[model samples]
Target: MSVFMVERDLKGISMDDLAGAQKAAIKTAAQMSDKGDKISYIRSTFAPEDGRCMCLFDGESAEQVQRLNDEAGLPYNRVVTALDLTP
Candidate 1:
């Protein structure tokens, strides 16, 4: 399968929410992304100033990615979009 990335905008999450030992949301997301037989990449970034989280999953299609996010208890409100700089 090909790779795909899902961009997320997380609002209302405080810096404290992103800090310390409670990283279950991120851990769950990684596990969910690895559920579809194989593993490629599962990543997330936070814009603390803006309270936004941009998550990227590289595997399968939009539907598969959405499913994984849903299973991970994440926000699945996404539009079909992508970018590639490979040659």
Candidate 2:
């Protein structure tokens, strides 16, 4: 699996809505995995001051990651291949 980053510009979005989006991503990913699509939500980062959000996922391709966001009804600026340099 490869890491993908989903970038979003969600200015003025409320906390409740942000949490709901996160839940949706997680649930949608699990459902996709159950149906044989290998995808998983890794983590998310948000800059509330500007409402800039980035979500990370593990999947086969950037298209797969984009599809996951679309299925979850999440808004993203782009999905791109990423390096998970987390320590």
Candidate 3:
């Protein structure tokens, strides 16, 4: 397992859509959390009209988590960093 700090740039996402996306995120988190792995959401900022949103996350490997997200049809926008935190 590893811990990473992910940062994203925004584009456009309505408040309603943001809520829906977050709902999806939480559901995805539940699955991720089940495997002794999880995501701790740091923050999210969005601009509704043009469709821009940025979200921060601190948790497992970005690569591994991306796979998990892809499995659930919710891949990450980008991988900020990935580091091993196993002891």
Candidate 4:
């Protein structure tokens, strides 16, 4: 599996929306696992000022991550493969 970043643009997003999206992502991850696929939601970075977000995930491919987002009804602008660089 590889890491991916899903980008989204949401203006004036409420806390409730973020919480709901997070929960849906978790459920989608579990569903993927049940299907024998490895996909997980790592975390999300929100930029309220910019009305944008970057959601981190680990999955087989960018497509898989996109699929999960779609299944969960999560709104995203794009999905890109990511390289984790930890200090």
lDDT of 2 by residue, 1-87 (tens): 999999999899999999999999999999999999999999999999999999999999999999999999999999989899999
1-87 in candidate 4: lDDT tens per residue?
Answer: 899999999888898998898899999999998999988889888988988998899999999999999999999999999876655
* lDDT tens digits by residue: candidate 3, 42-82: 54556656555655556666776565446555434675664
Best-fitting candidate, measured by TM-score? 2
Kindly give the stretch of ten consecutive residues in candidate 1 with the minimal lDDT sum.
Answer: 17-26
- TM values, all candidates: 0.60, 0.98, 0.60, 0.93
Per-candidate Cα lDDT values, in order, are: 0.56, 0.96, 0.57, 0.90
Error of 4 at 85 (Å): 2.5
**Residue-level lDDT for 9 in candidate 2:** 99
Clashing pairs in 3: 11-51, 11-52, 11-53, 12-51, 12-52, 13-51, 13-52
Q: Name the 10 consecutive residues with the lowest summed lDDT in model 3.
A: 1-10
